[model samples]
Target: MTVTQILAAPAAHTAGTAGPVRGRRRALRRALWGAQILIAAFLLFASALPKFAGQADAVETFTRIGWGQWFRYVTGTVEAAGAIGLVVPRLAGFAATALIGLLGGAVLTHLLVLDAAWALFPAALAAVCALVGWDRRAETRDLLRSVAGLPRR
Candidate 1:
């Protein structure tokens, strides 16, 4: 075969390999991230609804949560947003960033101004974010690479 044909053969083989490579990468990434997404979803649901009925500190809970019924709206929205964001290959890496930031602020609020018990909520979510960040370091690295405008170095 001609040199052109020889070069074309490798390109053609790579084109074929691309499909399986991407698929495996996607599955790996998804598996790593699925747990984090579930955690986010669960947190959103709980935060959206105060499960403890008629607890002694009902008013205090609402007050410390800092949004009353609006807390439901805000937490639900952010949690769901983060949940959805976790799936986007481009955004999943930083999904942990925004979420963990929120969780960190939450932990601080609990320590400083709210019930100590409330700290668990944010701490749990923060753990999820950290796990996601760690497991999907490659994806997060990809995200930061783009954000920093550097090549895939």
Candidate 2:
């Protein structure tokens, strides 16, 4: 075969690889985003559950946080809303924003007030948010463009 023929062969093969590479990237992106959503939902359920209703340790921990019953209700409500946003196609960008804020606050509370070793939950959540947000940047940007200046509900 000629030298030009060999060079052309690699270019053709690379072109073929492009589609598969893009597919894999897309799959990973979806997985990361789904994981973040699931984690948020789990946190919501755990934080909202009644103290001592099921587990003794959970009850003690809830009491230790000292957020009070009313605060628990508020956290649960917002978490539920965040979870809903995660699953809804139209609300992905909003969900990502909310999750980041929620996790950021958790980390701060742990460092400033709780001062507990178990504050890693929020830190991990924040990492997941960063990953999902990074993967979905283009999509989120398009969403923002679509919303333009619409008033929030």
Candidate 3:
């Protein structure tokens, strides 16, 4: 092949492959967003709302935990905030990381104070949050840098 044609071959190959790579990235991003939305919805409607509304089961659970009803409100508020944060593009990673911590506590509480088998739910949630946090590590780092008054990379 001519010198020009030889040098152009890799560029041509890359250009041809770029479309599929871009498409796959887009699909993966969409899937991640879908998972985030579903988790957020569950947190908001199924978990936080019940606590906020003073539902019987939530009240009973908090009572059993021996932290008083006020703790219930605090937990509900944190969950609600985390749920909202998961939907925010810039804050999703930080939110997910926070949720992982919260879920960790939940898992422990379930194992020690509540039903051991019930720990699985929070454990599963924490796993998903870990995935989200890892995927958005760049944004989380940028957020931390900004918080510390350092310039983002």
Model 3 RMSD vs true structure: 8.4
- In model 3, the clashing pairs are none
State the lDDT of candidate 2 residue by residue for 1-153, as single tens digits: 432232233332544565654455545656776786686567656654443244565445546678765555566567777766666666755676777887787777777777657579878877776665655555566677777974432
Q: Rank the candidates by lDDT, best first.
A: 3, 1, 2
Query: With candidate 1 superimposed using the best TM-score fit, by how many Å does residue 120's alpha carbon deviate from the native?
Result: 2.0
CA lDDT for candidate 3:
0.86
The alpha-carbon RMSD values of the candidates against the true structure, listed in the order shown, are 10.6, 9.2, 8.4
- What TM-score, over all chains together, does every model reach? 0.56, 0.65, 0.84
TM-score of 3: 0.84
Best by TM-score: 3
User: Highest lDDT among the candidates is held by which one?
Assistant: 3
TM-score between candidate 1 and the true structure: 0.56
lDDT of 2 at 109: 72
Q: Which residue pairs collide in model 1, if any?
A: none
lDDT of 1 by residue, 1-153 (tens): 432232223322544566654454445446666776676566545543343333335456656666675554565567677766776667775787778987897788788877679799779878767756655566677678988999885
Flag clash pairs in model 2: none
